[model samples]
Target: MRLTDMAPGMRLAKDVYDPNGNVLMRSGTVVTERLVKALRSWGIDEVTIEADAEDAASAMLDPKTAAEIRALLDQQFSLSNRDHPVIQALYGLCLERALGNR
Candidate 1:
């Protein structure tokens, strides 16, 4: 079956072929929500789940800032210099205001 047809946790094996029908690699576990969320928290969208295609594709990536973020994440460094702090703070404020601090 095609990658698009498999369920979230299902596994499938078939002859893996490149565009020229040459074996490129073998089957492996597909990307999952946990993996995608990990990437999301890092402000990167490299690993994609079939279900998150639209959101992943439409994500607003700031080229200049994303490059910096990518470098930080790749180096296992910090993002204190980026706007994530403010963005997350605003998100928390909005949620608290909307939900009344559950």
Candidate 2:
């Protein structure tokens, strides 16, 4: 979540930590004007927030799309030994890129 998108009364989904590793704000902390200002002063730009199940699911690749991507990756990597560790890692990265995860 972008700090600019946050509004008063919005609750945090996860704990926020400072660069020093100290807890800045706990999960479920309600956003307030003062807190927003403080976060800005601390150079915080984004934060994780609780997402609905539908929203989370929408961000993930569906099984069919995943399988299609995997098959394509397999074909692309066919010239290399699929069983080789390095090739397998490359395949994983290719799949991630194909699925828009990276």
Candidate 3:
């Protein structure tokens, strides 16, 4: 996709690289507006991103709505076995992705 059409919170489907072939960012890194500006300055014009079916719906949610959902998720996760590193990691990733509306 064209970098111009990208938005913050979109995940990269592939690694990005400089003209010299040095990796700029790894695959799965979330796109940010600041990163977009930097990439534009570096002459990058396109990127491959994950195709999310719910992205359009999620984008409509305001930060406040996202926060509310996060709070609910936090309450639910409190009952889980957070002592396990794997569960903690999973919850952390879920928190980041679910709260990406910010």
lDDT (Cα atoms) of all candidates against the true structure: 0.38, 0.69, 0.73
List where candidate 2 sits over 4 angstroms from the true fold: 52-102
lDDT of 3 at 60: 69
Error of 2 at 76 (Å): 19
| Ordering by lDDT | 3, 2, 1
Per-candidate TM-score against the hidden true structure? 0.22, 0.50, 0.51
Candidate 3 residue 17 Cα shift, in angstroms, is: 0.8
**Which pairs of residues collide in candidate 3?**
none
Ranking by TM-score: 3, 2, 1
The TM-score measured for candidate 1 stands at 0.22
What is the C-alpha lDDT profile of model 3 across 1-102, one tens digit per residue? 667667788888779999999999888999899989988988998776664713453556785786687688889888899889787656655654665545
> Clash totals for all models, in order?
0, 0, 0
> Considering TM-score, which of the candidate structures 1 and 2 is the better prediction for this target?
2
lDDT of 1 by residue, 57-100 (tens): 22345445444544544354243433576754443333222222
lDDT per residue for candidate 2 within 8-90, as digits (tens), equals 77677779999999999999888888998998899888665554421343346687776777787777887999899677556
State residue 15's C-alpha deviation in candidate 2, in Å: 0.6
